[model samples]
Target chain A: MTDIATRATRVVAATGGRRRLNGGGPRAGTIAAFLIPFFLPFVLFYLVPIGYALWQSFLVVRRTGGQYGTSYTTFGGFEQYVQVFQNNEFWSSIGRIGLFGIVQVPVMLFVALIMALLLDTPLLKIKSFFRITAFMPYAVPGVIAAIMWSFLYSPQLSPLIDLLNGIGLHPDFLGPGAVLWSAANVSTWLWTGYNMLIMFSALQAIPQELYEAAKLDGASNWAIAWKIKVPIIAPSIILTTVFSIIGTLQLYAEPAVLRQISSNISSTFTPNMLAYAVASGNNYQQAAAISVVIALITFVLSFGFMRLTSKRAGL
Target chain B: MSNQTLIRESRVSRTVVMALMFVLAIYFLLPIYFLIVAATKPQGDLASTNGLAFSHFQLFKNLGTLFSQSNGIFLQWALNSVIYAVLGAVVGTLLSALCGYALAKFTFRGREFLFSVILGGVLVPTTALALPLFLLFSATGIVNTYLAVFLPSIVSPFGVYLARIFAAAAVPEEILESARLDGAGEFRTFFSVAIKLMAPSLVTIFLFQFVAIWNNFFLPMVMLQKESLFPITLGLYEWNGQTSRVPLLQESVITGSLVSIVPVIIVFILLQRFWRTGLAAGSLK
Candidate 1:
């Protein structure tokens, strides 16, 4: 018994590092047992919802006879899609989120990259202190993050506003023109550290020896960071960019929370927010169409970006 | 540049980098620090005092008010969040590990296709699924219940994706083969051997799922209507929206926000190592 256990332990230790250990374990019945628990919920919650949304999107609510008649949904055949296409509020919400993503995602990712690089360098002291403090906001839910920042952005109670006023540089953080970026600022604060940690972990995985030859060649630290480290971590960057794009498309909680305090953020401030508004107004069919459209746009933009970058970078 | 000048320039640049990092740190932490300060104040002193300074010690009173208001509904929301997040993550992680281990170890037909479909599930924005899920749950008569939020929360494709990678890296097939030779069944071997091996990686998946479920607002927002079933986030949102009428609830909202976030932040800091490993595994690979 002892000898058999020793041999088994040796075998386990020896093959532990291998990636694939396929073709030897379980039969189909057993495999289905393992997968059914997850796949059932995945189908029920995930796949069914998408299919139901598509089905719902195609059916339009119509009255049985005249104005006072009972209402029921029937096949509308792209009528809802046409209405969605013609909606100025929908188009403007899309445009607004597009602009927000165009600006906020890059800005947030850039700061995250810089912070990650800085943390990865030998020049920084007390690294975890700075790292954890910066990352602390991520633990706060987005709604709470918005609530926290809302206090700072409000003119009636903000010390930061007071400080700015003291400097004779009066700024309106919650003004109509600035509230979108104000919401953007809340998102950047909440996510930059999380993204930074992603990039930083990637940076940490680069073997120290990869920088040895460059240093011997007298490459400055900046050159090594931009050339060797950044290039090596390009895949992680692309992955983060794709995740950020998906996140940007789903921007709801932050803007919705901000709308509680600011009159500037309308009901149709974002595509997801617009969907929620329409659904709340008992227009589930139109809302489903908007959701499908948003998901499709998300698919196109993220995949298109991946394809574009992979083609250009030969990644 | 000469070595002497290089040393001097290095000092300057290091100071510059450190300064920049310090500034960024302040920017990230400012709102949270402000929230802490705000939560400690009396309702009367909130607008009267400097927002970043402590006016007085009203935190306990505010928390009392938060938990005592409307028959202690805030406490119910907190308990609901804990139930939803903790239970959801535990089940999600277990299911993910089982499926991921099977995918890694078994060479079955249509396996890759199934995984591809699940991978695509990762990109689907969950907020888009909410309204339809709400409608479907309504159909099934599960709407506005704990199971409504808990059921959907257990289906994390990202958790499965991460688990597959970890299982591929961590669990050894030889051990499973030997366990099978000992006449142990597959489930028995998994529970006895594979789970022990993948314990560390499972913690990472658990933490990831926990945070995702805890941070989830939109799903529960759409699925549940009863205030008693609400998570801390939706509860606080409701409170914040009503702050204009009940001015005293502002302090409680701030206090509740601070209270709701403290435990998660503590857990996050405690399990900091798992997250870096998880992200490194997920992205860099």
Candidate 2:
């Protein structure tokens, strides 16, 4: 079996690795053993799916002769891509997501940065209490979180609706115009703490000497926080930004869950939703194309943000 | 500034900061508080009573119905979530540790290329992958089976990335050399020596994988159509999606959401140190 071959190969590689102590330049058999377990499934599941989607995206559906004839896939380069580009739903979903990401990512990250900074400051008490409570929603699956928030968004069941109504302000969280923001709020709730934890931990890694040095210069706390701490943790801020961008592009579960309660969320409310819709309608090639497009946009946005900020972040 | 003035200023700022945090905390916890209050209310009290107030002690009754409905499909979903998360994390962590340790300890020719490729895998949207994976799984005749989701859940590129860092730090080259000099093989050295050294990191990876798999909705939703095989997220979604036609299922949906999330929240809180540390380390790269 391949397992035994891998095991034997690894033993030999280890022996060779030890004897040479120079890393032996390479061990073709040895590296494959260790990498195979992860890579086999990684390729089959991760890489293969991506490549398959790309390949599927290129091939348009074809029938041999007529409507009653046997259906098959044939070479149709760029046909699916053309359709994906021409599709109004796809572009609108992208635009809607562009709007969501524009407003939500920054707002969420700002809150997270403020929180992380506050948690880092000596003024806050019961820091872990706040941290854990904020993080609790991250543990709630997106579907359940949406379900929970759907309750809070509902007029019949929401305490917020009641609270706002008593204040002479009527708010519809799931209204056609507001449902997108409501979904964004659910996301911000679920993620803000998780992102905060990332930045806070990065803040935690900052040595005490920098703060002491800044203080010795008679720098105020605000100056020290802004000029010292923020600069030091800019890389992490950039990181969380890139991740939030990627997450924004893949927005699915929240809107999909909210779609159950609100008709405002169309089948193609987000690109992922559009892809899922297309896939569900048995337009596999189109869905594959949409997924590829979404993945490219995610790639470009995440890397673009990282590259844009890396220099300023001092990375 | 005088000492008294400075003290007063600090105190004022402290109060302001605490008040701001307190309000944000309410925003975070309010929905959960609402969920707990609503879950305890019966089907009738759900709308009739105050949303924030517990009108009756119907939590137990609701849970009874939750378990007994459709002969305990909720329980099945709960169990499936556990099986997928627990087993997936264990296998995933082991696989990641092995590959990561090898990459760290061995300087293979193509290691950097391999690592970069895997790093790229981390950015590939998992939800996007679900559709194509469904297509492949269907062709292979394994759609709707546990393996459809389970196989994909265990391959976490992020976990592997974390493992590589941890292995390089935790498992010193000298220890591996010593283990090898003792006539132990690569697998033996990894099992008997490297694994023990990398225990905490592995736990972190396991927790990461566990959470990622547990919170996954789209993958299972795309993969499994069998009601019996559905994870709790998919199950709750299905129930919520049906509440229009079946008004009564709303109560069960609320109750089931509470039940499904309780264990994950508890585990996450308790294992906070392991994952928080891992995350801090993971994000550093």
Candidate 3:
């Protein structure tokens, strides 16, 4: 790592020297012209909206006169946040996704890690075929994947149900008890391959010399993988985990699509969906609060994971 | 004797691994296989006949109905999706490339600060912005318009991040210096020389943005109100929601879902190498 850093610095210094000899870098006008196009929309779409949401979250709606009076917004500090915290539906959604992240993230990452390790090993044949097949679902949109799986989950349509019944084992994929896991299944199917590719790429980056030493010491392939490869690829795993945590908290497309078919999924099935439902129902302030809360959770979890992993890696 | 035993052990382990992988492959392909088979079956056979088998070949009939349904709204949705995804991707890629190139090659004040701001944008979940964007757009009277979705979709922070990394890695300083020495303007040098070097990574960025826009649901769901403005995702989702009241629409929904995914799947398979490199770079970074 230090060698790479030194080489990078050397290259930068060489470029800096050349740049100075060439009458300095581009003028400020050129830089501004290039960057303004992206920053315009970025500020408009991303930064401005965040500020708007934060501002909106602090406002509350009030009926001025009677019950049927005109409704207007007033600055009510923390009122919307208090309502969100007190809302049963919001809590349920958070709890549901919390359960989802705890269970699904680990299971998906474990499966991905195993696949990555297997692909890294010499035992696998037709590696490209396996890799592509696994990664194919990542290309499928979340809505469509949920739609496709809903068919397989539907008792009226699925032949898997028929076969299972024939064997006297009836499975209810969209039952209230199982629908969350069913949604979890869709996410796992969609993301496992992508995560596997991340891990597999990291595994490929491991030095061959490190493994040669293990081999010379008579360490089995399994031992070498468990001891060396997994430890070396820990940072990659943490990265994927952070991404998965963020994805889990922002779970809307899958459950929303699945909600069409299954009554088990409520309007507030996920926090994002709940926020949307509220916003569509004309409760923009409260929706903004929910959005802020979800965003805060995502920020904390992602940054916390990064901090933990970097500390462990002694970076 | 030890060598023979080792060979035997290796054979057993290889077989186990192969079998495990084969099962996993089947698991991965099963839903897609089911969709294909279901798309080919008549409405009557969808529930009665086996899902894995074909009772009657009705793929063309389903396609016909899917296209002609609701005055060809499905096709309209498909067109809208293509326009939104393709145009957004093209514009987004160019903007990202420009900004990323400037960030990488230029020695401007507050460059790292600007890049850090963009990196912070990467962590801001877009879903959190949907409501506020809706409120803001509605206030500006742009809600329920194509611009609402298109404007937001084109501003991909992740795309900019990827482009910056790619620009830094692929475009060499010496080339830019030579281009400058040849009296080429900064924009001229970028357009003439730097873009060609960054073409592969640009394709990766384009593909990423394309998939993102195509898969986008929440933003469109909030931004657009007209059925005519819906993307395939929102369109199919609406159809899926109405399946209970209109059972016949189920088959069309299935067929439409299958139709919508084929192009994306084909793109993935054909551009497999770009995605592989993109994923590798993403993880490593």
For DockQ, the strongest prediction is 3
TM for every model, in the order presented, reads 0.95, 0.95, 0.96
Reference interface contacts recovered per candidate:
0.80, 0.75, 0.78
Docking class of 3: medium
Q: TM-score for chain A of every candidate model?
A: 0.92, 0.90, 0.92
Residue B196, model 2, lDDT: 96
Worst 10 residues of 1 chain B by lDDT: B103-112
lDDT of 2 by residue, B41-94 (tens): 889888778899888888999999999989999999999999999999999998
Q: Give the DockQ of candidate 2.
A: 0.61
Q: Which parts of model 2 have CA positions greater than 4 angstroms off? A: A1-28, A64-70
DockQ of predicted model 3: 0.63
Looking at model 3 chain B, which ten-residue stretch has the lowest summed lDDT?
A: B103-112
DockQ per candidate: 0.55, 0.61, 0.63
Any runs in candidate 1 off by more than 4 Å, and if so which? Answer: A1-24
Pairing residues by index, what is the TM-score of model 1? 0.95
Give Cα-based local distance difference scores for all models: 0.91, 0.89, 0.91
